[model samples]
Target: MMSGPAQKYVYTKLDQIKEGTVVNLYGVVKFFKVPYRSKGTDYCSTVTIMDQSNAKLTCTFFSGNQDTLPKIYSIGDIVRFHRIKITQFNSEFLGISSNGFSALVFEGTAGAPALPRTSSKTYSFTEEDHKIVESLRIWQMGQQTFSNLRLKLSDIKPEQYFNLICHLVGKAVLDKACYLLKVWDGSKCALPAWKVCVEEEALEGDADFLSLHQHLTVDVLVYDNHVEAAKSLKVGSYIVIQNLHAKLHNTCNENQAENSYLEFHLHGGTLYGRGITILPENDIDVQELQKVLTTVNLNEEPICSEDLTSHNRLSQKSPPFNALERCQQLSVTVLPTRQEWLTTPLSTVVKMKPPQKYRVRVRLRIFQPQHLYQSVKLHCTKCSSLQAVPDEERLDNILQGNYTNCPDTDAQNAYWYQSVKWKRNQENRTVTIHFMKKHDMLQIPQESLIMVEGGTFKEFCKLSRKFNSIIPVTCNQANLELDLSAPFLVQGNIWHYGCRNCSSLKSIEALSSLTLEGSWNATEIAKALGIKPLTYVFVMNLTLEDETGSLNAYLWRRAAEQFFQISASEIFMVNNLQEQLNVIMTTLCPPGKSIGEYPWMDCCIKSYHSCDGREEQNLYEIFDTLIS
Candidate 1:
């Protein structure tokens, strides 16, 4: 340690930064812009750094070459710079990289390897630098600044260029100039995301999976240079889309302008370091994303377990929402945000413009779907359709079809299925079984789904036990027509239905040429049958009141589940869970007490445009809050 005027310490901390002086500093990057091509034929990067003091310093660096600009991997990385000139700008100190500047970056996770992710090979890293980095990492681990840097899909607004950490679910080539990468972060966007139209065959991922996640998926159009890189990304790859431009979609292609709906684009060029970086499977960020995906089952088929054991296990693996503690609270405090100035009063939020996020402290006045069971509804992400769960009597009626008589047995695919004849009302009807090639005399329900044609409701109950799934179909002219009244497929004694408005039923012959990419995949089966499966979600409205005002906002999507700390689909399977929910609700809004006596919560509410044609209205939604 070189102290006592022999160069006392090697690096300057953020608090020691002064104006009109050239100094070397080591700090944690709170925020940064990907290196972008500037007007002067140089690449520039804007960054905000802080030390243990939490004093932020704004820095700008320009380089004739893109490689010289800081290659900041993320928002929380530690950076060391040599020879930066600091000057006062607009009553604040600004640092600009002067001549003979050198930079090195390191991961900000404490106890991790002290490795530099820099473009320069000749930069020096002494024992002192290592000590500073490890210390900074330890400091950063305790700060909420890292989480603040991550913007959720629910929080994104139009015309903002931001970085997104998400997983790819689907991809398609729009043309030679453009490619589409459909991704999600397990949160629903505020507005309806723009959908790109193309032949389903052109898609590189499961069509059913894409349709199932339409509510969560955002289509990012990669253009020019970025399209090639996007094409190489496989479905399910975890990636960081740096400097992703979010704008409204319109025929005029006006950049940074609002339109009817929003879309994301990676515009052509290396500007803004606008490219995708694939993260390893074992990456911490990827693991976080996977946890969200697993809980929601958006990437795969929903479990049909009879008990809540699976969902209970899921909760144990995740960060507990502490719903029990929250329900008992008499008062709730609003969580602090990095940009505290953005917090708006409820009275002001209603009058504000669309496409903005606000934080507010408010109390729960009341909530509805007063009949909690009614809140459990099936939603189609693909078509934005919401419907009630079909009753057993109604579903059974739909499954029972008119008796048909056909004498001919279509033994078309003897290689895959066996043809059976059923005598209905004294007439012989041909029932073609599409997946019983050479199994048991009576195939068990553990096998892949069996497609049956000209089958009835009574037939389903008998055959349901024979196979894992059963899809009843009818031949119309030359095309296969599935009865839209019933489920497109059924599995594990759980009835799953398709969205009537979204599904475009395909021919049974389509599966003749089908090749299974993986195991007995449910998503692929839905795609083969042109079925868009429905997702079960909880939806409710909460009337929140602050000192200023009260407004009606919905507790919807994943947030509702997060708030309850329970799965919507599994809530019904477990009797005690419903009692728990009732207890939580009653705690928030007591029956005997007046509205004034109700408890309060400091919530982060989002303001967005209503999709339903209340054109003059701006909608408010409660997001990211769990009671306990």
Candidate 2:
């Protein structure tokens, strides 16, 4: 006779349970519950039984009665419940509560043997979770471990989960718009605090596969001020999301919504891990894991189809400056280095041999009739240097327009750099010229057959119309031949300049150009010519001496006015004392082709005490007026 009724259910795993069979599984009771909205309100606690294989069976204790079960059926606590309804919700095993099966019996075993489990460490979620939350809109990237702590859910935003660890445990699936759950280590909390996403294939036993109740376990991420329907989690299905972040959501009146979260910024200091471990609780070395991950990423190869092709074209080009190295080595004459000023005292003049004179032919080209009418000649004498002319005497001559006269009573007195006679051809043309002797002309016979070549003959004629000779006047007596085909010699000095191989006198036969050889110094000039015992090579001194024998007076005023002003810088001539008294009348003379614009006048003014005297007289006049 078949038993009329079987009261005791035994030896059935929740995962292997078939329909029409009641299974009694003895395991630690894993509880979960919905959160209470208020202190006086209540929420249901759900319990679970998992066989040794980690497969689970779900059970729910409705509110109002489950408060007593917490004292005995706490999470991780082994227990047995009787009179449970054996039912299959979708394909998964679920136990329903009966009014008669309220108490936890001390002994009754079913699915797995009753066992104890350890509590897992948990961590609080942070804002970094929102950075890569795209999969769940608020899910963490993923981590290997967890800790239990009050997490901030509202901090999660959409599409931003990258680096965070999350822990979630709840019923895997829900039906009839209701389910039961309880946190493993913490108080029962609502699953609505998270957002849910689930794979349809994971839940196949549903009557209507896409139905909300058919969802096995809601997939979700936590967000907002409260848990959403999706975030309401379950037991036996925990999620550890990683890499989360936070950002502004919205605002409110007077009280900003941004300030709503009391503990939104929650980042747990990692414990139990070494060297920046994301899964510190696990025994795996983080360095090994990183290396494995990096290698896996590196081994991935790109795929290409058989017909793929890409092409690039190139052109030949040439470089610039290809011949630059060859151009720098061509012929070029280099001048001597410029002279540095000597620092010796003016009074300590060293008596030395005069600068030698290399005979240079100078052909003076006269522009006006007067210079051309007169015979062009340069007079040289073996003379001694007379004493310097007083400034008063020079000033009187300049004021009286006697610059053409010599101030010294002795007619033979002469000073270096002083031009005895100088005349200009026209404002547009230069009148007088001088230059060194040409070496080629020195070797020719006195009456040699001179062959005119190229345009040299015509050039020589133009130059010969202005000067008596091309060689220096000092070399006039030298036995030298003539080469009319030569280019005219040009000279630069204090008063005269121009092509010197021109016609200065009619009777003057045959002129040739000359070029000075050697430096403007004495020994070199003397050595260039085949002359012996060469006299002096004139050089103008810029420094002057005083009448009291001091070196700072107007001793070199003549040289300074000629050389310093002409060669060094522009020369300004003061012609009259009365006019000079009127603002020290200074005039900048145009550069004469001879010596160029020099600082001659400036040097003269500096050497003499005339400027000092005038300034003192002006001061004295002012004092007299003030005292009067």
- Per-residue lDDT of model 2, residues 77-119, tens digit only: 3444545666544245567655545333111122222221112
Instruction: State model 1's lDDT.
Output: 0.69
- Candidate 1: TM-score? 0.41
Error of 1 at 299 (Å): 58
Best by lDDT: 1
lDDT tens per residue, model 1, 174-203: 777678899999887765566665567887
Candidate 2 whole-model C-alpha lDDT, 0 to 1: 0.26
Q: Give the TM-scores of the predictions, in the order they appear.
A: 0.41, 0.18
Instruction: Looking at model 1, report the run of 10 residues with the lowest lDDT sum.
Output: 330-339
